[model samples]
Target: MMLKAMTVAGFSLFALVATISLDASAQQDDNLIPNDLAIEAYQGGWRSGGSDPTKECLAHFNSKYPTKRIQIISTSEESRKDWKGHVEYKYQCTAAIKLK
Candidate 1:
């Protein structure tokens, strides 16, 4: 009886570990975003155009991360006139997303 009980306890422990590992892996997969979309957004932000970065970023993200729908929550642009050389454009954006 003691031997049978030990075997059952061992099996239960193994099952518990397997379940926890699978859950962690699934959570990691859910957090992953398309690399191309993130890269494009970073690059577009550095470009010199006065164009809306949020639009460009979202467009790139949608095109590359076609599996998700992104909703823009807010957008803002700030410009500073410096006597130095060229006008500086700072763009900021916030968004929410639904993943499939």
Candidate 2:
């Protein structure tokens, strides 16, 4: 009986820690959204192309959320397309922040 009680207590403690860890990680993870409306700023043939979506998104998140350390991982990015006087580009980025 004592052994069983100890085991249950251990399991409960582990479960509580796991829940806290998951909650912390969820809080750290964030979806990046660029403040600038024009993620792909290439307006016309004469205009220069926009910055890298992943980097831009990372910068935006880092700047917006001040933290000791942060890591940005680009989950996926859209294909780049270009044509005469026209361009279409898009991408997505995610950020994982660490508290130092």
Candidate 3:
């Protein structure tokens, strides 16, 4: 009976450890990285005639990290800015995601 009890306890411990390890690894894989932000603007924050810089950011991350992906978590903020003489829409983004 003692031997059986020990075996059961050992199995339970193993199961607990496995659960925790999986959760921990999952958390590790989900990395919070910056630069996923995409802003619609000119090349120099000018009023208009630019593109999203964050697209390159995400692409770079994808190329640098194998099997990892970037997701736009949020559009953190947005505002209107006057550049030179043009009124442009500005956006601040919060981005995070990863595969490992």
Candidate 4:
């Protein structure tokens, strides 16, 4: 009877340890960046004659981080003429992650 009880206790301990290890690994995976999305802001500029500068900024961000989708949170535009008289556009964009 004593031998049987020891075997059962050993199995229970092993099961407990395995469960704890699996839980820890799952928690670590939850902390990984691939599972989470963080909002990031970027600035991009284009010559005046080009398409919308705000769109240009978003496009640039999408090109850089193709895996992540961008949602436009906000945008600000600045206009300044360069030496060549071409209007330079500066765009400030705040975006949230739409997908991971």
The TM-score between candidate 4 and the true structure equals 0.51
Candidate 4 structure quality by residue, lDDT tens digits, 1-100: 1222224645742222222236677787676446457677887745565667568767877897788777777888788887888787778887777563
User: Worst lDDT window (10 residues) for model 3?
Assistant: 38-47
What lDDT would candidate 3 get against the real structure? 0.45
Q: Against the unseen true structure, what C-alpha lDDT does each candidate score?
A: 0.58, 0.48, 0.45, 0.69
Q: Which candidate's lDDT is highest?
A: 4
Kindly indicate the candidate among 2 and 4 with the higher TM-score: 4
Give the winner by lDDT: 3 or 4: 4
Kindly list the per-residue Cα lDDT of model 2 for residues 7-33, writing each as its tens digit: 564574222222222566765575364
Candidate scoring better on lDDT of 2 and 3: 2
Instruction: Point out where model 2 deviates above 4 Å.
Output: 1-48, 79-85
- Model 3 off-target regions past 4 Å? 1-67, 81-85
Which residue window of length 10 is worst by lDDT in model 4? 12-21
| RMSD of candidates 1 onward, in order | 11.7, 13.3, 13.6, 14.4
> Which scores better on lDDT, 1 or 3?
1
The TM-score obtained by model 2 is 0.39
The candidate maximizing TM-score is: 4
Question: Of the pair 1 and 2, which is ahead by TM-score?
Answer: 1
